[model samples]
Target: MKWLWMTGLVCALFASVQAQPQPLPAEVQKRIDAIFDGVVDRWIVQMDRWWHDGQHEHLINMTYFAIMLDPHNISLYENAGWLLWSSDRDDEAVALYQRGLRNNPDVYDMYYELGQYYYIRKRDYAKAREYLEQAIKFPCEWFVWNTLGHVYARLGEREKAVETWQELLRRFPMMPVDQMEAVRKNIRDTMTRDTTPTAGENTQQ
Candidate 1:
C-alpha cells in the first residue's frame, strides 16, 4: 500500500510539471513565441530589419515562429521558403519546403514552389521534374500543369510539352477561361518558341 501511494504521488508530480508551460529557450523558441505574440502586427518591421541589416538568420527564426503559431497555416511555410529563396538561401529554402511537406502533405502548392526552386534556383532540372510531377498529382490544379509545361519547354522536351498542353485541354475544355488564360498562353508560347532557328542563327557566325 505504501509503495503504491508513493508511485501515485510521483506520477501526479510528473504530470503537473509536464502540464506547466515550458520556459522556451532563448535561442529560437523565445524569439519565435514573441513573434507569435505580436509578430504579425510588426511583421513589416521585422522584414525591413532583415533588408536593412541583412540579418536573414533572424528572419528565418521569425518564420519558424509564424509556422509554429499557426501549425495548420500552410501559407506560413510558403512565405518562409519564398523569403529564404529570394534572399539567396536555396539550400535552406529547400529544407523548409521539405519540412512543410512533412507537416502538411495536403499543401500542393509547396511542390510547385519546390519545383521552381529546383529548376530556376538550384538548376536541378531532374529534381524539378520530380517535384512538378508530384504537384500535378493533386486535384483542380490546372496551374500545376501549366508550370510543368513550362518546365518541359525549358528542358526542350517537345513531346512532354505537347502532352502537358493536351492534358490541360482535356481537363478544362474552357481551360483558358477557367485559368485566366495561363494554360493557353503557355501552350501558345511554347509552340511558338519551339522553332528550330536556321543553323546559321543557332551558331554565331
Candidate 2:
C-alpha cells in the first residue's frame, strides 16, 4: 500500500515536470520542489513512522494535509481514514471514508474498509453487511466476501453465511485450496452446531 503512495508521488513528479513551460519558471520549479519535499515526502515519512510507533494523530493530520495537496490521489484518502480508525476515532474515520467515496464513487476499498470497522470493532453487523454488499458489487479482493460471511454468521444467518462462502468459491475459482477448505469447514461446523440439541432439550428428552 505504501508502494501505491510512492507510485502516486512518482506520477505527480513526472506530471509536474512535463507540464512545466519551456522556460521552466524559477518560481514554478521551486513550488514543485517544495510540494514534493514538504508535503509528499513528509506525508510518506509520517505514515511510516505511524506504522513503527503507533502515532495515529500525527499520521492522520499529515494525511489530511496531503489530501489537501492532492485530492485526486485516492490512496491519501484511504490512509487518512485508516489513521483515524487506528486511533479509535471510528465515527470520524467512517465520515472521512464517506467523503472520499463522495468524491470518487468508484473507489470500492472505501466501502470495504468502512465495513471492516463496523464488523471488526463496533459489532454493527447490519452496517457491515450494508457496506460489504456495496463493496462486492465492484472490483475487490476475496476477503470482502469472507468478512461478509462472518458478518452474516454474527447475525445468526448461518444459511446466508454458507451461501456467501460458496459464492466466494464461485467468484474466485483460483483461490487457494486451503482457504476454500477453511470456508467449507466453517460451513460444516455452523450447520452441525445448529442441528445439535441444547443441554436443556437433552434433559427434557
Candidate 3:
C-alpha cells in the first residue's frame, strides 16, 4: 500500500531534476548526497512521519541524488516527478512523465499519470487522449477507460464517450454489476442528452 506511494514519490524526484541543470560541483554534490543519504537512511525509521515533519525537508532535497544517478531510470524519474508535483511543480511533473516516456514507455503507471497531467493539469484533451491511449494499451488495473470516457465527454464527443464505455463493457465483462449498469445508463443518458442539442440550437443564431 504505502510501498507504491513511497516508490512513486521517489520516481517523481528524478523527473524534477530535468527542469534544472545537471550534476552539481564536486563539493556541492557530496553535501547534497550526504543530506539525502541521511534521509534515505531513515526511511525505515520514519515511515509514519507527517507531511510537516522535519524529515521530509531532506527527503525532498535528496531527490536530486536520484536524478543524478541515471537519466534513463524510470522509477527515479517517476519518484522525482511525484515529489515535485507534491510541491506544486506541475509543469515539472509533466516534464518528468514525458522524459520517462521517452526512454521506456512501460515505466510503472506512467501512462495513467501522464493522462491525468494532460487532462486535469494541462487541460489539453488531445494530449490527454494521447497519454490515455498509451495507458489503455498497457495491462494496468487503473481508471484508464473511465477517465478516457470522461475525456471524450469533455471534448464534446459524447457519442465517443458512450461508445467507449460500451466497448469497455464488451471487453471487460467482469466489471462490477453496479458499475456495469451505470455504464449502460451513462451511454443511454449521453445519447439522450446529445439528441436534444440540435444543430440549430448549437448555432450562433
Candidate No. with top lDDT: 2
**Residue runs of model 3 more than 4 Å from their true location after superposition:** 1-59, 63-83, 195-205
lDDT of 3 by residue, 167-204 (tens): 78877788778777777776776787744333223110
Count of clashing pairs, candidate 1:
0
Q: List the residue pairs that clash in candidate 2.
A: none
lDDT by residue for model 2 (133-168), tens: 898899888888888887777777888888988898
What is the TM-score of candidate 3? 0.58
- Please rank every candidate by TM-score, starting with the best: 2, 1, 3
- Per-residue accuracy of model 1 over 90-196 as CA lDDT, tens digit each: 78888988888787677577788788788667766678889899888887466677767766766777678868877987886765574646566656655777463
Which of the two, 1 or 2, has more lDDT?
2
Please rank every candidate by lDDT, starting with the best: 2, 1, 3
Native-vs-model 2 lDDT?
0.73
Supply the TM-score for candidate 2. 0.69
**Which residue pairs in candidate 1 collide?**
none
Best by TM-score: 2
